[model samples]
Target: METTIALYSHDSVGLGHARRNRALAYALAEHLPDRLGGSVRGLLIAGHPDAGRDPLPDGWDWLILPGLTRGPGGTVPRRLGGDAEDLRALRAATARAALTALRPDLLIVDRHPFGIDGEFLPALRDLRAQGCAIVLGLREVLDAPEPAALEWERLGGAEHVADHLDAVWVYGDAQVYDPRLTGELPGALAHLATTTGYLGHGRPPAPRGERRPAGDGGPRAPYLLTVLGGGSDGAELARVAAAAEPPAGHHHLLVTGPQMAEEDIAEVRSIARPGTSVVRSAADVPELIAEASAVVSMAGYNTLAELLVTSTPALVVPRTRRRQEQPRRARALAALGAVTTQGIDTLTPAVVTDWWRQAVATRCDRTGIDLGGLAVVPRLAAELLGHGASTGRATTGHAASGRRAAGRRTASRQEVRAVAV
Candidate 1:
């Protein structure tokens, strides 16, 4: 029988969660038809009403909810412009109605389980009673575990997720950092935890005849490309990157993510020098990375993964205040010699410029870093659907154990050398 996966992405504030979930949804649908005897359909339940308006794949559907917003300290903002109780009632009604209508075989809750507003609880319970497989699609990091556990408990999130979720697919490699280090995966759901490695969003191939021209009229010499993952917390980085005067032979391309405010965009534009271009989001980032002499960016997981694939000489300026994930991820990559990292506290214009100069001069061979993350997406889809075995074998032959599979293929030639020597 065909499987229908309803993905609940309660992304009220930033583009990262929603964008990543969309990628998984697309992957599931795209890969299912070929692997499974029946097709896969996806329905995305968006907590942000405005989110549904974004373009989605053809087979995907959306159910918009009463909007939620991110408040101080990354907490879900309470309902506004209506009585709190009345708003909760209304949201509950809407959520229940939507769940009844969709009736999916699988429920993939992206990031959070209670749907941002605690309004999806009843619906989640009802779906579970109907035997729908409830899965939690968590990104690798969730700040710190103790604080997350307390907050989740306060919000009744931990209980809800633990009681209902059948699986928790963490989109990261556990060898890097344990998910338990960031959140309290309750004992009830412990057996369900699966490290799917990193489900990196794959980029399209570079277009034909799209080579960057050469010379002063050709591609400008030694230009730095500075980007913020979603631009929500990138004002300071944008300013620092924009204000830095490039060396005589260099230029800059500053891409502000779509989430950046207009005022911030204008501020970046005002700071742009003669050799700099300040653009609001572009579809050709991978192309830019491929052609650029170097790149400077926030260490968002997707960005870091892309850089690893391109092996582009780059520096990671991690975001620290919003969450600790970026810093940890950046530091990990730096440890691997995959990229240089500018600590969040030391990222002044002068410091950025210095790093840029040093980075441009550095000739680190990034060929040692693995770029095979994207190839794992199809494999993940097959594994999730129980249709194919992962190429790697479990170290202990038990799924519940926290060990990685042995005999996994290595992407870099260095891994081969390590194995050989």
Candidate 2:
């Protein structure tokens, strides 16, 4: 018997969701066979075209949707020359058709449950009727409580999402950051919530092509590294970090993410000092993160996950743009001493230089946080798929008091606990 899984990422913003799903695909491929007594094959249903750039598991492939770009108010079509509604219908139909043909046994949704503008709702409903075990994969930190709640309301409340999702897998250390405790996750979601730990301490997906190392395709030993995730709104940070000087005898490598504008890339490249390196993207970012003497980066979830899993000192400059997600995340990790943080608005070359001087003097201590999300997810997938309702309803537990309305599926939710290191 063989199992098929479909990983979906709305990707309205950057490649964070796509990268995370890629990592999960790597994890699932590595661990699922041993648990399920068979091989695994999957598709990465990503919104961004570039999501397919990364290498996938042997039997896995990419299904890129018409991309959605984030803006001041909300998301819009990335490139397709049509109105939002037209694109939504097209994407919805495409996703529905693909999932119906695949008939995957398990489906994992990254972050958004219904996807951008409910593009995923039709497919999710279609798959449920086909008996697919669906899980919602959430990052450790959403926005601050109020905004997150409003956003959740916008994305359909717990009951609406739960109708389609079998489980909610949180990809963060509970001890480090619990959305439930912080009200980022409403009480209605408690019965469905399971912390998968941070997804950092796991086998990394192979780069689709050769990774561009800092210099000469090797570790720039003792070099100070700065990474801007996706580079959509990272121009200011890149400019500031590029102007800063590293500690004595240390060079700096600033990676302006692939999504960054060409002009911004050029500007950063033009201003780069002799000892500083500026590149649009790098291969095997995790490899670079592991080898850095100390690091500076944006507080994007994937980047932060990379930073937290290592002992290399890090300084996070959170994005101060529309959403408070980045700022909230940087502050949480900063509170844990996992990484130092600075407001992008207040950031300056003097601050970067000063922070780097002290940061390199000592390595970070991240032993207390849970980092085993990758290993745990396969178990959850297997358990759910194995016990899947013939009717497609999940056996996931209900909230205390069993407040579920009549006709709703309810079962005891099993919580996955993390032992502190």
Candidate 3:
């Protein structure tokens, strides 16, 4: 019988989850042929606002769900022009139909265990009842230890993993940030976890013929690239960089991701100096990374992974106001000599230009880090389905009440599965 895999990506804030899952699905499609020696199938359940943009792979297809957005408060459905209740019902029904149609032998869910708004629970329950092997995939850093634990407990995330998951794959190296230690992952679930190293931005997708570069009507020239993921809260960073004085002969490409407001994009464009261009999106990031002399970006998991794989020397300005995930990841990458880090509190045009020069001059060595996760993740998936090592026991348990034995609410969340040495 052919093995079928279902991947669910519940993306809210940015394109990270969607992009990562897309890469995983692509890799599986490419590899399952050699591993299984026959036929394999894949289904992707995605909700990225940009889901319609990217090219799809062969032997795999995606179901686009109603989009959602997240804020300091929580998540709310997006793109429905009618009543919120009606949209929610439509979203629920869509999720059910997609899962039932796929009826996969193995289910791999990104991030949230119960999924955003618990929309995945019904399908998860259905799959669980059929004895389908399920896996929860996590990035290297989620947030600082304390708040991450609190958020997980509050959302009943850890309990869900313990109860319903067959395995937990952390797409990172433990030497960087082990989830068990920093994130305070519960021991029971921790036993089922595996660190699959970060996934690489494999060969850039071939552009449809006649594609021009960042500038008007020509191939894009080599330039310094700046990507402020999703661009929702990166106006200040974009504004400052666009206005910065660049080294002579250097051109700039500022990609203010899809979520950036139009007003903010206009503002950045107004201040953009000569030889600098502003774009709302990029379909082929790996190609852009290759064309870039250097990169400046936030320390999001997907972006950092790309930087590491491309060996692009980057100057990272991590976001630290409402969340600490980026800052922590930036510090770790800096310590490993992968990328340079700068604090937003001390940012200035002069400071940015100096770092830009440094990045342009330096060539990063990626020997110390792992970029084999593009392949590792698929192997892990195969293993979960009884093809490799048997996945550890993952019997379900009662949902956590989001509290310790005490009645008090806990504070903070952590991303490390084990303490880094």
Candidate 4:
């Protein structure tokens, strides 16, 4: 018989979680049929008010929940306060209603093991009673160890995952780092863990006739592409990048993520230099990265993965106010010489410009860091559906060839582990 998979992604704050889940769903749909003996049906249970605004792949079904939101000026709505008790109640009610309706064979949750408000537990508990296979998918980094430990404990994160989840699928290479590096994993989770390489991003082919506009081709221009993952905390960064004066013949492409306010967008637009192109989000990000001389960005995992794929020289200024995860990721990637890191507090137009100038002149081989994310999706789907490890060999043929061409840079397993943690 065919299997039904329901994915629960609580993307209450930014576009990263939802975008990642959607990419995984698409990959599962594309590969499950050939890997599994039977067909697979998929559904996305998104708990974000803005979920609809995100573009969905064709042939996917979605159910929206009453997701919470942070108010203007990055404040949580006063009416809701930050009380865990009240939030959990609301999340529980929503999850109960959705699960009762879907009755999925497999439930894959993106982060938040206990749900955004602790509401997911009841639904998850009920689903477990009914014999559902549960999996928890975590991104590589979850912020510096101390705070993460406290937060996870207070939120009952470890207990919840151990008691109810069937497996834990960490997206990155576990041989490189363990979850304990970021925070303490409840002892209960040790046996249930599995590493699936990095759950890399998927790459759809460039749309037809989508070449760079006439007169826009040739000897890589001295330009930088500046991006904020969701544009939630990027107004200042965009302004700084826009105001900088580059060397003669230098230019920039500033992509404001979709979440930026209209005023912020206008501000970026007004300050753009003659050679700068300030655009809203575009589907052709990979193409832009491939063509750019260098990239300036916030350190969201998806964006970092894409930058790695292109091996584009980069300057990463991570967002640090609301969430501290980006800064940690930035530090690690910087350690590997994959990109240069600038903390939000010290980022200035002059500093940004100088970094761009230096990055353009640097000769770093970024191929080592590009994890070949797009190729991992099909392989993950095959594994999820009981097929052996056929996906890796198929998708990474080119990457393997490239690695051979570049000559391997061998790091001890211990070094790789230290980097991952």
For each candidate, give its TM-score against the true structure. Answer: 0.80, 0.89, 0.87, 0.79
- Candidate 1 lDDT over residue span 263-352, tens digit each: 999998898767787877655566777667778899886676566657468878888885677887777778877788887577777887
**Best prediction by lDDT:** 2
List lDDT for all candidates, in order: 0.66, 0.80, 0.73, 0.66
Ranking by lDDT: 2, 3, 4, 1
Write down the lDDT that model 1 would get: 0.66
The number of clashing residue pairs in each candidate reads 2, 4, 27, 4
Q: In model 4, where do residues sit more than 4 Å from their true spots?
A: 54-58, 71-94, 175-177, 182-184, 204-222, 361-364, 370-421
Per residue, candidate 3 scores C-alpha lDDT tens digits across 84-183 of 4565567668887887766676788888777666777888887776557678888877787888788777767676557787777888878877877775
Q: For model 4, state the Cα shift of residue 23 in Å.
A: 1.2
lDDT: the better of candidates 3 and 4: 3
Stretches off by above 4 angstroms in model 2 are: 71-74, 214-219, 387-421
Q: Enumerate residue pairs that collide in model 1.
A: 213-219, 214-218
Q: What is the C-alpha RMSD of each candidate to the true structure, in Å?
A: 9.8, 7.0, 9.1, 10.3
lDDT of 2 by residue, 9-102 (tens): 9888889999999889999999888877899999999999888877787999999999878656667789986688788898889899998788
